[model samples]
Target: MGPYSGSKSYSGGEIMGLKVFFSVLAVSVAISGCAKSPPPAPNHLIMLTETADGQADASFMEVDTLEECESRASAAKKVFPMAKIKYIRHYCTHTNIKFEPFLHNPEPEGPSYVFGLNFVKDGKVLSKVSNFKSMTDCENKGKQVCVISYQNIVPGE
Candidate 1:
């Protein structure tokens, strides 16, 4: 039975072409199946406040959208008419000290973590917020004055 044998015959080039076609098809399917999903959007808003002396206060509110975050800020302003409120995002430091909400030390030898609505201010961050650590810390700084507040960008609900 010649090269046909009982069925058909394929040349060396034709066999290689078939193998390459199937290999490519399989790879495409595998890659498509492994496509990564996008990251989730922000869904919670954090409200942070700091007095002139440097003590800070923080609160978190779940929000569906940016508009909802703003709405909550408006409501908060009504309750705290004297506060200077702004909107920002919250990112934790490697040490995650900001969440501690307590003084690392009266005079921090290492970096101080700042837990407030606005972690960044005027070109400064946690270390420069002041020596104060909490609301009580601010009171200790001196006579109370203006309270600076921030509404953090919406995060996970």
Candidate 2:
């Protein structure tokens, strides 16, 4: 038998090698198509004034567009009516903020806020005072950290 007599084995190996190479190429193409796109630019901006201690001083609002950023500053006069608008920040994008179909609170009559004061000593929660009606009430308890939780429900138009 000549060298060509065993050519079936060589051709079989070549076919198997080609199949493995094509399989890897197909997987790489599929993964590239499944890659996530970058997030879109923020559509709305939030303006707020900061206190000396870097905390927002009762002034914050979300705007619709970049052009209205200046006009919104004038509108904020009704909230503070004295404090000037100094800090403007991009907060939400069109894709990020989605309207909920159902209401958070169906009745919407009782206290809509829950404030809690937590005292932590050496990475441990020593004591926690919760269920305060307002921020001032939670502050009166006097803890290292205060956690405020509240949700707003808007009726469908």
lDDT per model vs. reference: 0.44, 0.43
Worst 10 residues of 2 by lDDT: 93-102
How close to the true structure is residue 28 of candidate 2, measured as C-alpha lDDT?
99
- Identify the candidate with maximal TM-score: 1
Clashing pairs in 1: 43-155, 44-155, 48-117
TM per prediction = 0.37, 0.36
Tell me the deviation in Å of residue 72 in model 1: 4.3
Shift in Å, residue 28, candidate 2: 1.4
Q: Give a tens-digit lDDT track for model 1, residues 70-153.
A: 677667666564545332333221111222233213232434333222233321222222333554556556533212233222
**Candidate 1 minimal-lDDT segment of 10 residues:** 91-100
- How far off is residue 130 in model 1, in Å? 24
